[model samples]
Every structure is written in structure tokens, then in C-alpha cells.
Target: MTVSLYVPLASPVHRAPAGLKLGLLAALAVALFVVDRPEVVGAALVVVVAVGLLVARLPARSLWAQVRPVWPWLVLLLLFHGVFTDWRTGAVTTLRLLALVVAAAVVTSSTRVTELVAVVEWLARPLAVFGVRPARVGLVIAMTLRFIPLIAERAHRIREAQAARGAARMRWGILVPLLIQVLRLATTLGEALDARGADAPVTPPRRRAGASTS
Candidate 1:
């Protein structure tokens, strides 16, 4: 299910500092988890929807596109939870989880990957005292964020290619290739970081290549 929940627009939420938005999202998730009340979750969901509309300036249609993808999963989760647990509590927990997920999507849709990296860097600064390198952490986070969309695009292309080759009906063809491609991407990313001396100090070249060399 594709959720038409967010529009790629230059709105206040999009413009706000990523750290602030991240903090808010984190706090909201924690608060929701602690409360565990349907009424509270419903209220939070309302706030999230309002923020998506008013702060994010996302049109209803666009928001639907963003959310539609997860609707089926949400439905399935609700069914599973309701059946396995007490109906009332299961329904509440499912709704709460859904609210949290939707709220997170709103933030991701509005915030750019660069902004998120900056936020992570800022947030990780304090952890440096514990021997954690904030800059390195930020770089990892940035790389991961950058790769998400790329992976999605690659998966789409792979699916299309498989369909064209009349292998779309075969799950392994798409799944296996997608997994391999993602692993390849991860390897490339690691190689790129190593080239940049991410894990250690770099040594200068002992002999430079000739200027006349192609």
C-alpha cells in the first residue's frame, strides 16, 4: 500500500532544523509508547495528520500516495494483533504503532537526507566523549539515508526488467537480484569509505602519476 501522506513541498516542516524535528519525533514515539491508550494514540494521530497537512503543506491527495503503500500492512497487522491478543488491547496497540509509523513517515518526507545527517551529527556530538566519533557516525547515517532511495529505485528497475523478461511471476528472480544488488551497493560504499581513509589515517602517494598520462 502506498500512502499518499506526504507531498514534496517547501513547507515549514521541510524548512525546520532537522535536529528539532528528529527530537520531536523521538519524543512523540516515546510518549506514545508510554501512554498505550487508544484515545491518546488517536489524539497523537490527529496531531500528526494536522502537522502533515498544515506544517508540511502536503495536499490530501499527496498524503494519500505516501500512506497507501502501508495501508495493507497496517490492515494485516491489525488482523494479526486482534486475533492473537485481546481485541481491545490489540486494536489499541496496532493503532498506536500505526500512528508512530505515520508520524515517522511525515518527518522523513519533509526532511532531506542531508538535513538528517546534520541532525545526527549534532545529536551524536555528546557521544564523542565516550570515544564515539560524531563525524563518522554522521557519515554512516548520511550514507545509509542516501542509499535508501537508491535501493528503492534499483528495486523498481529490477522489477521492471524481470517483468519485461516474463520472469515477474518468479519471486526468486526479483528477490535474489535485489538482494545481490543491495549487497553490491554495500560493498561499493565500504570501498568508497576505505578509499577516503574513513577508518584510519591515509598515507600520501610516494610517487605521483605523470601529468602526460591519460
Candidate 2:
């Protein structure tokens, strides 16, 4: 089961270039990380959310729903940061990551995964000069984007199945089976790729030895 965060709303944000959205998201992420002041990050979070909601035309309910699933992790982050660092620092870090997550959600919801992969391939084109394959990078990006929702859905179903079987309390047991399930899925994917031409080994370019004077 794939979890779709996309809201089909005709808005400028939705029509914006995937490359531009990705770049802006990257810049904002760096800015949030670089500026550690809680006030600044908190304010930035507000702007990010507003852009995601108002500018991106994402329904407020949908935006909040995407964020809702992250509360447990967010709490853990704050607790860890607070225990080791100051509360202000913790708040700054928490808000910074939350802002990035919201920003990414906005981008992903608006843009198609194929568009993003094309942008990545374009961005990584220069690497081809150094014997690197940009298509591989694009393929990895596409696979990652495709797999995130699937993996999450699988984990959810696994938890539900365990609960139904009276093993709800055995979280550790669920982990083992879930991991094995994921590994099996990976193996199947690998086999499919092998059936295609993607299994070919990509050898690195060898460095030439410098001229030696006898």
C-alpha cells in the first residue's frame, strides 16, 4: 500500500520546476541548520508551513496530518537534545528538522518523482565526465522515493498483523520479521534488476601511472 501525500490542487507551487523546488528546499535546510537560534528557526518553521499550506495550496488538514505521524520521533529528538544540550538548542534542532521535513513534504506532494529524478540526473551530469553514471544516481533517487511509502505501509501492516495475533507486546519479535520481510523484498527487486541489464558491474576508471624517467 502506497501512502500518497499528494493533494491534487492546481497551484503555482505545484507547477513550479522540480529542480527549483529541490534547490530551495536544500538552501532552506542548510540555513535552518546553520542558524541555531530558537527564535529564528521557530519563525522559519512558521514561514515554511505557511508556504506549504498557502502558497503550495496544500490543505491545512493534510499538511498537519503529515506532520502528526512525526510527533513521537520529534519528542525523542527533543528529549535527547535537552539531556545533552540546552533546551534552547534542543528546540532549535527540533524546529530545524521539522521545518526541513515539512518543506520536503511540500515538494514531494507537489512534484512527481520522475521530475525529481530528471532534475537529479541533470544536476549530476558533470559527474559523467569522471566516469560516473548519473543515471545510477537518478535510479537510486527514484527507487528511494518509491520505496519510502511502501516501507512505511509494510511496517504498519506488520504491526497490525502482530497485534491481531496476540503478539502486540512483542515489539522485538516484530522487528526481526519485519527486517526479514524487507530483505526478501530487496532480494526480489535485485533479481528483477538482474533480469534486466542493471546488474552489470560498473568498474571504476583506473588512474594512469605517471611517466618514469629511466
Candidate 3:
């Protein structure tokens, strides 16, 4: 089964406007970096957890699934900082990253794909002056989010196949087949998009010189 990042729920977080959620996320990211104190970051992390669990009402498993793949990297980050710098720095840095990741997972779980795409398209509207297609940009964002879980699923399947073949341990050899599969999928998707005229150029709206475009 293909696992989608967006969870279906009627919670307040889920009903919040996508743009508002994204804006708050951006603010949270900036605040976390600006305040380097571990206590502040820890407090922010607590708030994030409360929002996800209590406000969003998301199952802990859903949040864990998002964080599980990155725990190894987080461990490595802590070890690296602890070795060169200090344990306090390591703890703060690790917690900062963990908070960001979980916060992002919360946003994705609450927001629908279409809602996200619409927000992206709206944000990209100004770039249309430079011949950028907002719709295409939105499509790219949508595809990126959609593909993350799909690629992870494919890698899991490849690992299972390797294990079934009596491979004693996971090896780098899986990358070869995984790459091939990804390339094939991309080619098929591209062909389908072309058939649907997704590559067609969009015409920009005309604006009068005496009026404000905004």
C-alpha cells in the first residue's frame, strides 16, 4: 500500500489554512535559529509536540514513521558535535533539528496535497513576470511530496527482495536496481505529463500601465 503523508482528520490544525500553517512554520524555523539557547529550543519542541498530539490529534505512530528514517542521522550529528564541540552544543543542535523535522511532519500530516499546491502557486505568482509558470512550480512541489514516501516504499521492497534471496546483510547493491526503477518511473511520468500537455507555455495576464498589479 502507498502511504500518503497527509492524514485525514477533522481537527482544528487540519482545517487551518495552508498558507497560515506554512507561514507559522517559517516563523518557527527562524525563531529556533535566532534563539540558540537550548532551553528555548526545548520549550519550542514541547509546544510542537503538544500541537501535533493534542491539537492535531495525530497518532504517535504517524509522527514516528516520519522521524524513524532520520534518527540515524540525528545520532551521527550528536556524536559529531559532542566529539568536536561539547555535549551541550550537540544536544541543542540535535534537538533543534528534531523539532524542525517533527514540526514539518505535523504540517504535512494536517495539510492536503491540493492545499499545499495552491499555496505554492499563489506564492509563485510574482515569478510569472520572469516567465516562470506557477502551475508547473506547484506541480513540482506536489510531485516532490508525493514521491518521498513512494521512493521509501520502493527501497523497502528492494530490501525485502534482497533478504528473500538469502542475502546475509543489506548492501549497496540495492542502489543499482532502485536507481533503475526510479529512472523508469520518471520516464513514464514525463511521458504521461507530455501527453496531458503539461509542458505548454502559460500566457501571462495583461496589466494596464496606470493600474497596480498587486
User: Which residue ranges in model 2 land beyond 4 Å of their true spot?
Assistant: 1-4, 132-214
- For model 1, residues 1-214, the per-residue Cα lDDT tens digits are 2232234688888888878888898998889889877887888888898898887876766667667788887778778778887666776776787777777878878876667667778778999889899889977766665677787888889989988988778766677888877877776777688888886866654565674422
Colliding residue pairs in candidate 3: none
Global lDDT of each candidate:
0.76, 0.83, 0.89
* TM-score preference between candidates 1 and 3, better one: 3
Using TM-score as the measure, which candidate wins? 3
Worst 10 residues of 3 by lDDT: 205-214
Best-first order by TM-score: 3, 2, 1
Model 3 residue 74 distance off true place after TM-score fit, in angstroms = 1.8
**Candidates 1 and 2: which is better by TM-score?**
2
TM-score of model 2 (CA atoms) = 0.60
Q: List the residue pairs that clash in candidate 2.
A: none
Indicate the residue-level lDDT of 126 in model 2.
95
Model 2 residue 84 lDDT score: 88
TM-score, candidate 1, is 0.60
TM-score of each: 0.60, 0.60, 0.67
